[model samples]
Target: HTPGYGSAAKYIGSITKEVIRDGLVYDQQNVTLLEIMGRNAGWLTGAAALAKCEDCEGPDMIFLPEIPFDVENFMKKVEELHKRKKSVVVAISEGVKMADGRYVCELTGTIDYVDAFGHRQLTGTARYLAEKISREVGCKTRAIEFNSLQRCASHIVSRVDITEAFQVGGAAVKAAFEGETGKMIILKRVSDDPYICVTDIYDVHKVANVEKKVPREWINEAGDYVTEEFVSYIKPLIQAELTPIMVDGLPRHLYYTDVEQKQSR
Candidate 1:
């Protein structure tokens, strides 16, 4: 797993719990669609399952890009859930594709901008799906996109992730100082019980542009949720929180200002 993934997963998991609670406040039938960031991998979307616990049932369903999405089946599931309960929460990766290999969001015809890397700027996925559910399932719907918040939620960052990030950076610098080239620093998990990890340098050629997807067994047989093993693997990463130093009701940050630079000069 990448350094930032742990932090992102932490945020995603916490938010999922909060959303699940909020969804239950109303007595009417409602469906909430949470669109998480993931282009080809569903690691972040899978994190939503971490919200499951005794108090909360978590998301009723989770869809990942690793599996082809069936819109009809998804609708049927939501309708069935509505019959049993008032609120239905579903987490879906923004990159979920149909059997025809087209992104589910593409069906909305709202994606026109493409990045330089030939990747479509994926957004409005939750909105599109929420609208569909509201229309077809006839339930009140909400579309929530975690968006850039997932990446910049430093206030809720995991302490382990931050420490590992610094360690990985230091490892890279140490490697460069030792005349190493064309290599990348990667974290190797030494153990899971105590959650120990160490940084090691690997050939960049072999590591770069490689996508490590969530294992098939990590997902349930129905492909609507993640398994216990997946939860166990991620729980350790999001264990400890690094509370930000707050000043005047806001988190204080360290930075070099122009005045400081001029004074030094």
Candidate 2:
């Protein structure tokens, strides 16, 4: 996971809890599909599991891009969950694709172009799944994408994430100044209990152009949800919240635009 990912994941967990609270307002059964953005790793979407603390049920199912999307099985899974709970929340990574390598959104004829890196720009995975499930299961379905909100929601930022992010940037700059030209800065776990971590420098040649998929063992056999092992792994990163300063009735943000405009004059 990248430096900003922990904060984004923390944002996702907070929002998922809010969505679940909103969805269960009425006595009627409902399905809320949250489309989380993560290029390939389900690390961001996996934050849904973090919401399953003592008071929250969290997402009933989490679909990661690591596993191939199966339509029929997904429909069945939603149906079963709907029968048991009035509110069934599903978290899906936008990059989730079918076994045949076609994105789930592609089935609906939504065309997306590839980037210079040949990565498909994906969106609308939740909407596609919502429409499909609403037709088959005949349930009240709502779909929402976190989009840019996940990255910019500074109000609910994780303190752990922000600290690590700051350290990584400084460490990278130091490494460069010391003539570590081909090195990339990465966090290596120092301790899990006290949750200590240290930044390590790695060869950019070995780390660049490589994508790490969530380990197959991290996902359960059903392929619908992540194992507790995965839950334990991500929970610590989202441990503490960093509350943003309040201005008037809303949270204040530090934006570069205003500063840039002032400097230009």
- The TM-score values for the models, in the order shown, are 0.95, 0.92
Question: Could you tally the backbone clashes for each prediction?
Answer: 0, 0
Best by TM-score: 1
lDDT at position 201, candidate 1: 90
Off by over 4 Å in 1: 259-265
Which ten-residue region of model 1 has the weakest summed lDDT?
207-216
Go through the candidates in order and give each one's C-alpha lDDT. 0.90, 0.86
Best by lDDT: 1
What does candidate 1 score on TM?
0.95
